[model samples]
Target chain A: MDVLTTPLTAFSQYFSKSDYVLALPMILLTVFALGILMIDLMLPEEWKRLNALTALIGLGFSAAAVFRIHSLLGPEVSCIPGFFGTVVMDRFAVYFFYLFLVGAAVAVLMSVKYLEIERENHGEYYALILFSVIGMMAMACGYDIIMLFIGLELMALSTYVLVGFLRRDQRSNEAALKYLILGAFSSGIFAYGLSLFYGLTGSTNLGTIAQGLEKRISANPNDPVVIFALLAVSTGLLFKIAAVPFHQWAPDAYEGAPTAITGFMSVAVKSAAWALLLRMFLFGFYPLRALYVPMLIFVALATLTGGNLAAITQTNTKRLLAYSSIAHVGYMLLGLIASDGTSNTTGIKGIMFYLLVYTFMNLGAFAVIASLRRREIIGDDLDDLAGLYKKAPVEAVLMLIFLLSLAGIPPLAGFYGKYFIFLSLVETGHFALAGIAVLYAVVGLYYYLKMANAMFMREETTAEPVKSSPSMSLALAICAIGTIGIGLFPNVFIELVNWSMSGANAATIAQLMH
Target chain B: MMPVATTFFFYFLSIIAVVSAIVVITRKSPVHSALALITTLLSLAGLYLMLYAPFVAAVQIVLYAGGIMVLFLFVIMLVNLEKAQLEERFNKQWQVALIAVLTLGALLIFIFEKGRSVFPQTVTNFPENTNTQVIGLLLYRDYLMPFELASLLLLVAIVGAVVMAKKRV
Candidate 1:
């Protein structure tokens, strides 16, 4: 017994408890998704909401794991290397993991009633969302290019199907097909760039890639491969984030998708893509800052104007939100542009805070829109929401909160998100760009106010009262609280965001100097 | 072993690859284009073999030529191409796209020629040994994470195929 146990113990030592904790959220999600699929097969039609309950429980467990791991992360971004350094558990990744969990939970809550209303309530919906979360978790934590690409695919493929879930609806099918084609093309471009990066560095782990890139750049100042890699990777990622020139599919997809799914895409997908972009550039392409910064500046200006100007023309609320989301991507890019590729805490912090605020504000707005949608109504137009104040006072009030926040009015979550980015831009001496962004933001206010006015002033077209479910209300309450909580008590969130980025900035600066 | 033979084969492969690629773009019939693509892929695989990358050659044939080509043809058959052909052959913005592409091509050529010295020109030193053992060891040890992640990607693809393609489910 002693002889047999000795070898087993040796093998077990190769794996550790930290590995389990580092990957806890992804593990919980995958298991629950599979478990739901199995149980869904056995359950009767009346027990459909049971799948939503299981998904919620799964999300809860993952959220609990995130909290447990939260204390382990120090103020300094501590990288707990697991799986041969492919998965780096850091404060930055932890922040996003928490975001993904909260977003998934809200989506689940919204899905329960939304699916029931549409009569397409099934277990697959919950399972696919969980699968997408698993992908997001992977994207957040992955330190290697392969891990990141696979995660991106997992997320994209699942969402593509989720978009076309309503097979009977022609608009949904059209949007899904368009998304799939463009998404796959961008992925190919991304893979080509990644392969070139691998060829030059002879490695895929971002830390080593950065080290290799640093050496290569120092050896030859104008390495053409460096410029090409930047073009390829940035283009691929920009498409995913719905930035300009590559954002054509976003409005159609967002307008056509299930409202909860639209919210999920707006929040979860944006967060994951931005995280990957930060990791790649801040860590991997820091040496070529001069080459990439100008590219980002042009992109930021284009995205800001394109998204806002297009959004102004949209009469459909969902399409308007879609373009608005693109515009928000432009603001977030300002944060990236201001980052000195070193210890620029304000820049990364601003981006992180904005994403967090956005998850709540955007999801809250979408949740209200989902609640309004009925079979006969299909009420996504501005007219449908007319005089919402009279029909559902509470919903109208919640929508107003979201609109004001989005409009960047003071004492709301959205304002702070924009304020931080603007501060960072000003601090970096990009005063002119900051001025332009503010001007566009003012233009953005008009459309948002138009919708707010529709909700408040116009008379209702129909006689019946607007309604909602307990689950939808619960989701809305969480979002409303998140929106107000971060806006009012800025100290706590700012401190946390500052700490999360503390490790990455100092480490990046130190790595370069050596 | 013969320099002349190698040169002749290189030219043969290049002609096949380029010709087939042009056919793939220009052919009106989808099936003909797909078949042309398979030929192009196979010729590229031959070039890989000539470069002493037997393993890559095998994969190019198996995955791209065999697996992906089948999928491409399946999709082409599924769609109604006759109706598609009746529509406009080119986009309204084709002139703009063409100019951008031409400019990009010129810039790429200039960069390659000017920066030729910076780019490493590695000597052809193919290992006499096979790659099977090397890749296997690397996959099992050094690239364990990516290796497993590949499986997860396939699983997602399977799920997507079912969820999107199947009508009854």
Candidate 2:
């Protein structure tokens, strides 16, 4: 009895009320996910769409909680380290939380009709999305490597299942298999790197690991252990973002998955990886910036060139978007490379802004493809998009907006994503990389115009009208509005990005103690 | 200096682990491969025990050598082994794979050789009797978040497995 009481007291000391408050968003999502699973059993087939509504409600609640936390903490005290620093609720985490919730909510909206068309409508789909949203939230807030890794696995596992959700489709099965195998391989490499870091630093906390890395760097400036660990970790993250050399899995996975899932994967999953990458590099591996920067430049160049070149040949719409998403990763990497060490966070801000904007435009583009799905036709080929304007004028116009934005056409939101990244690059004086990035942008413009040409110019092939469900239209409207709104009125969103970045810099951890 | 018996046993177990791991991959027969994998896992458990992590050793034996091996054997038995044996054992890109493997091996060797000095000669020792207790405390308290999140991971895996394996959802 004495032993049990002593251990219980010690365990109780590890948590507090604030910790639960800090984790309310994840808790709410988990509870909702479980609730959906439980309620799924009693629902009739006609009411299956209710699962999507529940998921959206869960995302809304999570977003409100994040907003409350953000408002309460404000800009001055940005970082709130909880659970003994395993997680942190900072401006960065808050910003990404909203981004992820929006991505998931929009995805849930898109998934309802798409899953029904696929004849795979089930509560598990919405529950899985919520679970993945929780994972993304965790990834955003994870202050410890263990937390980050678990979050990554949770997100990866859910996405893998979602990718293969269409049980009857052979392509879907193939895609999920390729994604699972490659993803598992990369995770192994990632774990190896993490274990090495733990062995070298004797700590899993990012803050402590940064300190340990600094000491190790001073002792041996060119230690191969540190280099190997950096390479391995970056490799794993690169695979997630679909960067070149490790991007072979992307086109297959994207092409094979359900259209809504492909959209979700392109936005939410990629953003979570971006969040993890930024946190790990900016917080834990900042000392090795000099080494990683050069490596990133080469990879970014390859990714840009490879992604654009590959997109030109893809007749399949999903495959084309996959390559384009990889190209977008190149631009984001440029932003990361240009982060001015400890002082200026212009590049980091640029990345956050770009991810936010990309979520809208990219998801909008995919939502259009999802809207085109009918009983007879899958509507994924460039030819399937022929005469979209003649059929569904609103969706066609909306898609035009998304494609133009994606291509970095000025006065559009997509241009601002590129603008911020290029601005950061120039600010840090990476003119060569910036110039190369511009060249790829032109190549990107060509393929995007190709898609637009198919929609507005090509003769109508299929006689069947497009299937634009209400939920899908709402998703498209949200995305289109976000894309146009950000493009036309960039100042407000720019200020938000600035505010998030100011509180998320290297000084964030220092302010945590107070 | 390490005791001769302990060092010898360490090297012996390591050799067995390495050899059996190679055999596990290289074997043509599925049953033989599974048996070799068991040998590898057992040797790894022995090595873990030598490192004074008795709990990890026990888990390795119970989970890998015992439980997973049964699953592996079942899978091997269920699959059409004769037809699998007749199929091409290697893909057409074996040459490319060989080159890639060699390059990776060389890189790893170079890294290990260069970073050898950074590794400490001795590891910090925990009280062997209290190893499990300390780990339990860490898992439940300091690592409470990840521990809880791991349940979510397992749930996702379970759901994913069911979704993939079930005939209909």
Candidate 3:
């Protein structure tokens, strides 16, 4: 009891000392989300497009706020306090806030045309996406487990609806039903785990939990209940990350959802999940490393095998990308497995850098997919993309960059992302896992190139030309610039990732050594 | 003392929960399924009461059994159920049943084998009264934010369901 009250009092004192400049991005996003919801309600049906525009304006302001906060805080500022220590304003969260805002902005841009064609364009659609983005931002900034769970559910519930946005489609309906049942089940399990953890630790704050775990482990290391609680928590996070055995819904959901929304899911949700995963594993469960490392390695292996092998046989473009995202998750887990005391910093930095690069390439690839629509046919199949270069040179070229980047070809953003992740693996002396990762990367590259070849090398089968909208073009351009820019000048992002990891490492070490 | 009666109550509620859950899955009529679910919900509430969470028990009965189940029944009736195609509502997998049985059997074995070691005997001394007031106090004082946010979530769900089910503007 004294423990909890002390933090509250100290937090209040901290808030009294601090200013609101650091919390500007979160404030902007919260107001923007509410504003968009209100505008959606107020506007007439004819002005529904205004909802999308509103989301864009809100996201623009959020991006500006992120930049402003980052500049003001520099690399060392720890923005804490506010909302009773629920939100942690720091470089790590600010980076993810920018990533999610940019990703949501691009998704909204792509949705404008796609929703029109599908006749599912409604204010609620844009409002839900914005709400989910807000949820992701909340999860990124959350400092407490209670806040984390709330943010997580906010994102999950909205996504369950978004996954089945096209109600007329039976596949979409089935996907939504499956997602809801499984997501709710996992959430229940997660909540149960959290309750147990809180009972044991006497607090739900991450920092406090870390301290408690360190103390408990040092006092008596073999408590079976602690092991069980850790397993349950890791299981819940694994479900969110779509790690093996829990990833049965991803392919179906991705294939069934709107393409642009799938892009948003692929990048934004994955990044947010990784952020929470990093915080939990690097803090709360660090003392139980012996238990988690093997479990993580096994999951990484299964995810890699499942994703890469399934992707090879996929005929649907969305499902292929779904599998590809799973494979990327496998690589991310490699970083986690390699995160021992010696190289924990590098592992986290690698994950951050990969997430940064992945946001651009994956979103850009889906943008091209969104652009591949005509009067009668939706471009969901690989054959639909046949001879895309002949139809739309710019879209095809953009897709080429995206595929190459995903394939980790040199001088592209994806290459650097892979390089950093693999470098971290090698540095941790996990040469065997690094080797397998490289081998799987080759397997992944084959399919990416197969798609690229189909686009560039094949002859035009259909006479109808592909059209690109201005919003989509702008999204693609931003993604393309980000991909190339990060590839050429990786230092700025590397520095930022290093700075974030340093804060996380210092906090982790402090708790552990105490 | 009514130790035997208490044991009987536990067995009776367990049977009720199991039977209703089965009915929920296997009943052909949607109305029957919904009613069965209400029964399951009620039995679960009773079990919660046995476990000394009288507040959750009441909320379970009122919120889930009364409100949500009624809403489910209403939706079932509101839709054109008579004209709707009545096909197999579940996956036709005979192997799945076998797998489920085997898995449950294995789980039972594992639990029986490890139960003594895994579950330490700890006596829970409850207060003389465990009711809605105590629960409400705890919720407001310790879990204030989550309780408030849960209401907000329910509000979102209400608005979302209305928007989703409504006809075009």
* Every candidate's lDDT: 0.84, 0.88, 0.78
Q: Where does candidate 1 clash, by residue pair?
A: A77-A503
Q: Over 4 Å off in model 2, which ranges?
A: A1-13, A506-514, B1-52, B57-66, B69-116
Best-performing candidate as measured by lDDT: 2
Q: What is the lDDT of residue A416 in candidate 3?
A: 81
Q: Write the per-residue lDDT of candidate 2 for residues A1-514, one digit (tens) a residue.
A: 1221111022235577667777899999999999999899899998999988988888888888887778756544656667767887777888899889999999999988988888998899899999998888889999899999999999999999999999899999999999999999999999899988988888898877888888888888889889999999999999999999999999999999999999999999999999999888888887778888899989999999999999999999999999999999999999988985356677888899999999999999999999888997999999999999999999899999999999999989999999989998898889998999999999999999999999999999999998678899899989998999999999999998877787677344463222
Residues B1-169 of candidate 1: C-alpha lDDT, one tens digit per residue: 4433388899999999999998987777788889999999999999988877777888999999999999998899899999755656466998999899899999999978875564545454546355556666667655666676567667767877777787766
Worst lDDT run of 10 residues, candidate 3 chain A, spans: A1-10
If both were scored by DockQ, which would come out higher, candidate 1 or candidate 3? Answer: 1
How far out, in Å, is residue A226 in model 3?
2.7
Which candidate leads the pack in TM-score?
2
Displacement of the residue A131 alpha carbon in candidate 1, Å: 1.5
> What is the C-alpha interface RMSD of model 2?
1.5
Better of 2 and 3 by lDDT: 2
Q: What value does the TM-score of chain B take for model 2?
A: 0.79
Q: DockQ of all candidates, in order?
A: 0.33, 0.51, 0.15
Query: How big a share of the true inter-chain contacts is recovered in candidate 2?
Result: 0.64
TM-score of the second chain in candidate 3: 0.71
Q: Could you report the Cα RMSD, in angstroms, for every candidate shown?
A: 5.8, 5.3, 5.9
